[model samples]
Target: MRCVVLPGVYPPQEDTLLLAAALRRERLPPAARVLDVGTGSGALAVAAARHGAAEVTAVDVCGRAVLTARLNGLLAGCRIRTVRGDLLCPVAGERFDLVVANPPYVPTPPAPRPSRGIARTSDGGEDGRTVLDRLCAEVPAALRPSGVLLLVHSALCGVRPTLALLAAAGLRAEVADRALVPLGPETRSRAGWLLRRGLLAPGQEKEELVVIRAERV
Candidate 1:
């Protein structure tokens, strides 16, 4: 699907495609509701709508991203509710049958949280679990019974920890899919730092991206 990404919004990348492919494999129930957290370009949101979701909500902290998602959804002839807020905040008290996220998971050197622009798309903090951890903690509460959460992140971010966290949250979690993708610009830019931190090996140009599926049974 074509998306009109705004200047500062994050365009669809390999991670986005991975998560969307996983979403397509899901057996969404009739009248299923789906939530796309960090819907930068609304790619996943559009995918969900086209996948037969009864209602799709796309959320992002960036205003431009939210606008981009709305426009893309309209262009795709999909009815999507777009909201600008931190992950899952705007949908507080709401529940969905499926929640999809391709949040920031690139490990960055210690620095203040990004408040704007494209940096927000890949600034996953030092250990790269910043947003992933929060998603594990909060997504379960946002899911209806039998709901599923499909999240994609780099292996450098500690896949086991994500599974453990989701398990501790009372969800059945497992690695649903994985791919070795060449490091993107953001990851390549921090390759040296990642190697120093042992998150990357010497001359490692490819990173493993995993799609984790957690179901609230």
Candidate 2:
């Protein structure tokens, strides 16, 4: 899908495509409602809509991303409801049959100043779980019974913890898809920091991106 990502809005990347591919393989319920958290360019939202979602709602914390997603949805001939809010806050108390997310998962050093602009797209705190942990805790609440969530993140963020958190939330979670890709610019820039933190081995040039499928049953 061709999406117009405005300046500062995150463009769809490997993780987004990985999650989208998982979404395509999922058996969505009839007239399923879908939610795309951290919608960014709305690529996943558009994908969900095209994949037969009856209604698609996309949420993003960045205003630019919201606009970019909304515009992309229109361009793609998909009706995506884009909202600007943190994580699932915009859709509180709403349940969806499917949810997808490709949040910031790159491990970044602790800076005196918080990440801003496009940096926010991949700034996953010191351990890279800051946002991922929050998503694991919050997504279950937004899912309907039998609902499925497809989330993509780097292994550096600790997949086990994500599974544990989802399990603790009463969801059945498993690694659904994975790919070994060269480190993205964001991750590459932090290779030294990741190595120091033991998240990356010396000279490890590739990062494994994992797509986790969690079902609320």
Candidate 3:
């Protein structure tokens, strides 16, 4: 399949398509401004454009990924404003009515994988909650009053704790979708072993992606 990320950058464009597709089907209000965090290959930004969002802002920490996202936006005929900065760093002065993030949720490092963004961010930190924690805290500030924030993360990555954290952050969250997939031998060997031993069940090759939307209250 054609990769979504630019050559040599990682996080093939195909990686974000599933979540991007889901965002495309959303019914947005008039002239809604949407922000996509961790926009590795610009998949979500392009998808937001396709979904009829009036303004789309996509950000990534890696410069190569930012350039790739810009090119993808151009190729897709979308005017996604690409920003080179860490999460919420570049877009400090902006707020969006709708925000979507496929942030580096994967906290665990990949087992010699081709792309790092897809697998590495999969580590949620110790209990797979690091990235989610930042989202829970920063997302609210990045969203407009009454804005909607959509987040997709692994259930094995402390999904319940993530929900609780969101609530504590003053955002009311509700699950939107979930999917489970099997783990690879290498990952199952490295991270999965700890998870399988009655622990946090992290690093599972077969795991669920829980789609959740929280409104800034």
Candidate 4:
């Protein structure tokens, strides 16, 4: 069986694992220079390398996640450069032909599992716009002209609002792909948590997983 990524230092979540599976089923164009932001388990990064991306840089905010990405790269026999810093922080002055982010878009508090690395922002923080705001701003600088940016995140994390933010950041955005999947345990629990805080609908967890595609203008 072909795996999207060989096992990494940190176990991959179901969505990311599924994302890799989906990517493997597609054929990217030639000489793609790829960057995988928030690269927790290095699944997408390794996928780019294994499938022949000319350049691959995998970065994450968590120090441990970097180690995991490195280990995963090694185990998979793919030479991916792993860095530690907050979204695009380590790669300042660098650019890529394709940028991928599975950010902490989960609109949850800081109580999420430290090791899951889902990229949760502050307290689901007022319409869940925290991390997406930063990412929308940061992505354009890193994207090469004609480069594509792919962001995988949730509907409840405010995809519409995020699209607006991306436009304000001077990037053209579209929903290139979408999926409906089981919310992770923490995201599933967001209903009660948000309700206690006087937010959320009864069935908000049945949310869309959007793949926001972007390009530098």
| Top candidate when judged by lDDT against the true structure | 1
lDDT tens readout by residue for model 1, 54-160: 99999999999999999999999999999999998899999999999999999999989878988879999999999999999999999999999999999998999
Best by TM-score: 1
Q: What local lDDT does model 2 show for residue 181?
A: 92
Q: After best superposition, candidate 3 residue 35: deviation in angstroms?
A: 0.8
- Whole-structure CA lDDT of model 4: 0.71
TM-score of each: 0.99, 0.97, 0.82, 0.81
RMSD of each: 0.7, 1.0, 3.9, 3.9
Residue 152 Cα positional deviation in candidate 4, in Å, after optimal superposition? 0.9
List pairs with backbone clashes in candidate 1: none
Model 3 C-alpha lDDT per residue in residues 1-217, reported as the tens digit of each score = 2335655454632235546656766778889999988877777888788888999998877777889889888888889898888788888878898888875554454244334444443444555566678878888887777888888766656678778888888888888777765653323644544555454354334756677888878
What's model 2's overall lDDT? 0.91
lDDT of 2 by residue, 1-217 (tens): 7879898888988888889899999988898999999999999999999999999999999999999999999999999898999898889999999999998888889985354588889998888898999999999988999999899999998999999999999999999999999889888888888898899999898999999999997
What lDDT tens digits, residue by residue, belong to model 4 across residues 33-84?
Answer: 8898878778889888887898899987667678878877888889999888
- Give the lowest summed-lDDT range of ten residues in model 1: 111-120
The number of clashing residue pairs in each candidate reads: 0, 0, 20, 2
* Per-residue lDDT value at 63 in model 2: 91
Q: Rate the local accuracy (lDDT) of all candidates.
A: 0.95, 0.91, 0.71, 0.71
| Residue 183, model 4, lDDT | 65
